[model samples]
Target: MDFQKRHALIKEWMREAASMILASFQEELTVEVKTHRNDLVTNMDKAIELFLIKKIQQSFPSERIMGEEGFGNQFQDLKGTVWILDPIDGTLNFVKQKRNFAIMLAVYHDGIGQMGYIYDVIEKELYWGMKDQGAFCNEEKLPVVEDVSLKEGLVAINSGMFATNRYHTTEMGLASSGVRMVGSAGIETVHVASGRLAAYLSYSLCPWDIAAGKVIAEEVGLVYKKLNGEAVDLLNNNGIIVATPKAYQEILTEYLLKK
Candidate 1:
């Protein structure tokens, strides 16, 4: 399968996409609301996704692509090699802050994740993982997060979860060292996978939002699951909690599992 070559190829494509996105910041954006006022999409997002899909098609013509920007394939099953991408994650951040957003992509062969890449575009840090090979930030291998309890670690929670108090999210924050809101699932999950944060809980997320992070989380030994403790279903937009093992158990018992 030449998995190493495929990994390198995907990373190269991501770098090119990142360059396109960075160049767009100098010009005015063509932005529109997708689902609501806060749900935004910019021309740069669509352009980057198209660029990436083109690169993938030129390199791996047989693989299917599922992208957040509606510019890729529509598939009913995940039976073969598939590329999942969120071209510009945290679009709001990109529009407003212009720095916290990221570009994420993951490769799944026969329904098993083989590689994941999350590029913090402005930060210039690339978090990538290959199945059985471990995860890395740029060239340095990332260690599994330390086994920390809720009280000892920082937690990241999404705005929806915080607003609704979904699964007692406020209580969960009180239990942890503190709560952080990165506004970007990819960046938040990268923090968890790299031990900078103990966990990230999101009330709603589509496959592209977490797919890349999931691959990296698995490689780093973090647990990825629904807030209710069920396995993550890659096809569904559901509550997600990705964290170090010990913190997972603690948050599940003390916060999510509670009424």
Candidate 2:
């Protein structure tokens, strides 16, 4: 497969989709709750999903797509080329703060991630990775992150993880220099991938939430695993932890796996 060509095409689709999202911000969003009030779906999300789905089907009819807004393929198996799309990650942040949200997309072939893209929409920064080609932010290549220990580096966690003490993450946070809770999983994972945060722990994420970030994290030598230290299953609603290798082992052994 021509990965470079595919990468370029995906980026083009993302750029146009981004424009659509930005335009929606100017208009009043028609919002609806998905499973709960906090779980939001706007007309914009559906629109972007449909747009990207159409583009992908037209370009690669044989490939399957999994999207957050349910506008793509319904297949559960990642047998062939599969595209995972999260048109607007952090919908609450988008609706309330109008920032901190991201657009995430990833491609996996036979369950192996081939490429990933996370665009911080308001920041206008794109973080991307190609399997063995390395990861990048904008035009600059991102260096492999050194293994910063828990004591020396900050950590990112969400409220649910802290409230429930999921995987004993509250204790894990105490071991770190500090804790940050960003509403957007994409942005938080980018911080880990970029070395700005030593670890990021989140409870209960769908594949689309971490799909793009996982590829970027792995490219930079960050460890991506289930919070319980199990291998991540892309099809499951798994609790996840992305951290430097050293921190990951420590968190897993001392905190998550201690009990």
Candidate 3:
């Protein structure tokens, strides 16, 4: 596969998606509840997801797509080239703050992540990575994050988890320098990848929520794993932790695992 060509195409598609999302701010959105009041879906989310899926289908007709908006294929296994997409990662943020949201996409080939992208539309920051080629923020290459311990750096925890003290998350936050809640998994994951945050812990995240971030974060030497210190299953929802190696070890051994 010509990864360079695909990468270029993905960037183009993401930029187009971003433009669509930004333009929607001028218009009233048709927002609806999905699953619950807090869970949301908007016209822009569906539109963007469809737009990206169309682009991928046109370019790579053979690839399968699994999207958050239910516009893509359904599969039980990751046997071939697969695209994972979350058109608008933080819908509530988009609706309320109109910022802090992101568009995330990832590509996996036979269960291995081949490429990942997380685009912060408001900031125009595009974070991407290709397998073995390294990760980048727009044109700038990202370096490995510092191996900071949990107490040495700030962490981001899911608000609900921290508030509820799920898995001793409140204690974990107390152990860290501080705790943050960015709401968007992609944004939080990139923060960890870029050394802006020591770690990100989420009690629940779907495949699309973390897939792109996982690839990019792993490239810069961040550990992506389930809360139990196991590999994340890309086909299912998970409780996730993405952090620098030292932070990961400390969080797992000292906080999460402590009885």
Ranking by lDDT: 3, 1, 2
To one decimal, what is the Cα RMSD in angstroms of model 2 from the true structure?
A: 1.0
What's the count of clashing pairs in each model shown?
0, 0, 0
Q: On residues 5-50, what C-alpha lDDT tens digit does candidate 3 reach at each position?
A: 9988999999999999989999999999998887899999999999
lDDT accuracy of residue 256 in candidate 3 = 79
- The lDDT of each candidate is 0.91, 0.90, 0.94
lDDT of 2 by residue, 36-114 (tens): 8888989988888889889889988999999998878787688989999999999999898889999999999999999
Stretches of candidate 3 off by over 4 Å are none
TM-score of each: 0.98, 0.97, 0.99
Which candidate gets the maximum lDDT versus the true structure?
3
- In Å, residue 45's CA in model 3 sits off its true spot by 0.5
Judging by lDDT, tell me the better candidate of 2 and 3: 3
